[model samples]
Target: MADALSQFEHSIYIGSYMSGILYGINLVMYFLTLQGLLRKTNHNSPKSRRFFAIYSTILLLLITIDVAVNAVWGELMWIEGRNGPGGVPGFIATQTAAWYQTMGSTAVVIMIFMGDALLLYRLFVIYGSKYIVIAFPVLAYLAGLSLAIIELVIAGKPGGNFFHGKSINFGTPYYTITISLNIIITLLIVSRLLKLGKAVSRALGRDSAKMYTSVAAMLVESAAPYSAVGVMFLIPYAMGNPIAISFGQVWAKIACLAPQLIVLRVVTGRAWGREVITQAQSNVEFLSNGRPVVHASGIELQSHGTTTLGDAATEKWNSSTKSLGSS
Candidate 1:
């Protein structure tokens, strides 16, 4: 039991250290994302900008509260409560259902939910808003949400422990379903982007297709790191390992970071939005002269005896190329 207590304390200490680093990184990224969204030169609609601004702000606040709560809990466990009852381990055991701990757990849940919701929204948009494609995912998300709620309720009860008894029973399945959802959605989004990239390549050249097919674009669009961290946490967690907490801490921060990265792309006019497919399919035309013409964002590209593109098209194309190149 002493050894176990030591392991738990070490796990929390390491997890907290990593969480702090991630939170700092997240803070920097949040500000950058916000700046991009609010830039006057950004072409996204005001409504879109406003929505993302609020979305990012809420995520920031939740993560801030989460980090702060964890810090307080750590102090209480290692210092204030260390000499009470049976020492630090006993204090932890007794306070498993404490309000601060519950709040931290709740913040993590909200972050996961928001991340999964964003993934679903991206999947919906990528598939051209076809509700049929997302029917099962939506059901799975709802089920996960229900389980999370139940698990939280169980953990918040008197003498409750998050990693034991009924709490673990519900928590295991809740995490399994939610993490599985992220993995499935990431694969789907990446598959769709790859397919579209192939078609764009054939029509508009590899350079143009790079915008959709690039590694960075796929990583951001699919939130691959978020899914990766979830898998890392879920595996050990399911096996009842103490180290799971460390991965879980990183997973929570990545949940926020992933969406912020996507939002940054969106605000910069580089993300694959709802109109990407439509624009790719409808914008390319073959003239009677056997020359290809491309239209994008109201700008025209004509391949005469010599290829010529309008200023707006050239600028947009150049910007995309630069973004991909830098990435």
Candidate 2:
């Protein structure tokens, strides 16, 4: 039992240790990217700053909690002479983790509900009709909270000397709730992106903007598969098959780390995107009398607009005015 426990213990340690390292990398990138975003945000505008505040708080708290509970707590739990209650099971370890666990509980509270609300806000960008009326961020909150509470209350209790290959088992359908939410949210976001893509295609008649959105959607889509995989990792742990689940975890690790980087990059690259937007091709045409007229290519951003620019420029100016080609 002890060896079986030690093996499980070591696997968990490995998983969390890897998770902590990735989280550290991601948190640093998030911070750097957010620093740039903060500089651009209108500090006085409540709406403009809300997302930054919320996601930032979550990332900060996640890092803190993960470090305190998973990393620090785990280390301390074993440090007190391995088979004994010396390290994390000791007073100092409990104190550090107890507070962070409480904070994590709070963070999860917001994430379960408010996070989904904030995510669905993007639906306004895609849907032209009443589809979003079905959205219930409040419901998401309630369901998520209920699931979290159920996990804590119903799961079995931890065994004696928590470090010596023994733990409390608390199995429930909590992850099912979480996974269902993932599918729901991913589908929502992808649907919105699709609609937004078509609208942008129709309005801007351009590819650059679409390329950006497509890349973003690709990044988002990449998440669902990986999330599905990562959540599976929890399943084995939750269901008492932890050893069978540990071998092929690279996907989960990459899934968790890569999305954060992609999101951070997009946030940082927003300025670059705007700069591209502002630099759309422009030209001035002249009447026979030499009066200047303004014309621009359709914002559609083809690598080469197959139509002749000279003729298109002349035609654009002509199309915009009552007097062009009249003289």
Candidate 3:
């Protein structure tokens, strides 16, 4: 049993390290895509660029710091056991390392909070600021935050052991709340897109309607991975399994990359606007002077009209749900 437990811990450590590497790779992808967008096109205004830059940079920094903390703590607790605090002759069996509980868990919680908040903002924008639509998510967010604080306090207590003690109770439910929050937010966003797609389908045609559904699919593709990973993280831990951090450690990367992928897609002009249809789809031959034209019951819609940078920024930051293709 002891040997099995040791192997389980080892596996979790390896998994966490592997996930950290994946996070680094995704971070590079995000940077490269953002660079290409800014260099190749003027779709994002200066202010918009600044906002994205700040947001991306902060996430990168958080991941970097968290990974570093995990690396150092793993080395101290697992590797150079005789040279560290947990090395006091079988104390490792009795007491979990403090760093994983305090600093490591805190980093994980912070990343989860940021990711959820950003998704919440996106949902708010897409739903045309209907507070009622976001009421449940907002409540979940608050509850999650409160539980996270409780976890932090428990983990930070003098000589507290998060994984093997009563503190694990707080951590488990915290993960549950985070998972539930993400699921709720994801469903809300997807439902909105579906409704929008049906409306667009009625206005335009069957073919054009697929784009909106595609958007919904895109959202699910982005949002689902991290939530799934969060569930992976929670289940093992709740069952007193040692390999839970394998899933927990990598979710930060997924959460950060998902929204950036959407932004990158929109800026690249392959999605997010009707012009993509004019360029990519041949059947949407409704083009006037090389611009996509939309006819909704004989009402002409100019889908490619230029909006000022200020207008674009306003639409994004002010959370306006006005359709760019309509009027």
Best by TM-score: 1
lDDT of 2 by residue, 155-242 (tens): 2223222211222232234445555665566676565555444433333344634543566554443345544554665556555664
Better of 1 and 2 by TM-score: 1
lDDT of each: 0.81, 0.44, 0.60
In order of appearance, the predictions have TM-scores of: 0.87, 0.60, 0.73
Q: Candidate 1 lDDT, tens digit per residue, 205-313?
A: 6776676779989998999999999999999888877888889888998988898888777777678865556554454545676455645544344443323445675
Q: lDDT score of model 2?
A: 0.44
What ranges in model 3 sit over 4 Å off? 1-4, 82-101, 199-212, 215-217, 220-222, 266-327
Model 3 lDDT per residue over 1-327, tens place = 676567566755877677677777768767775685467444555666666667667767766767777677666556567565546334455444464446666766776787788778767656665678778888888888998898788767766666657678887787788898887777776766665554444334556446446755556433767677778778887987767756656675676666565555444433334332221232222234544344321333444541112333323422222222110
Winning candidate number (lDDT): 1
> Model 2 — which ten-residue stretch has the worst lDDT?
318-327
TM-score, structure 1 vs. true: 0.87
lDDT of 3 at 279: 19
- List per-candidate RMSD values in Å: 4.9, 10.8, 8.1
Position 32, candidate 1: lDDT: 89
Please report how far candidate 1 places residue 60 from its true position, in Å.
Answer: 0.3
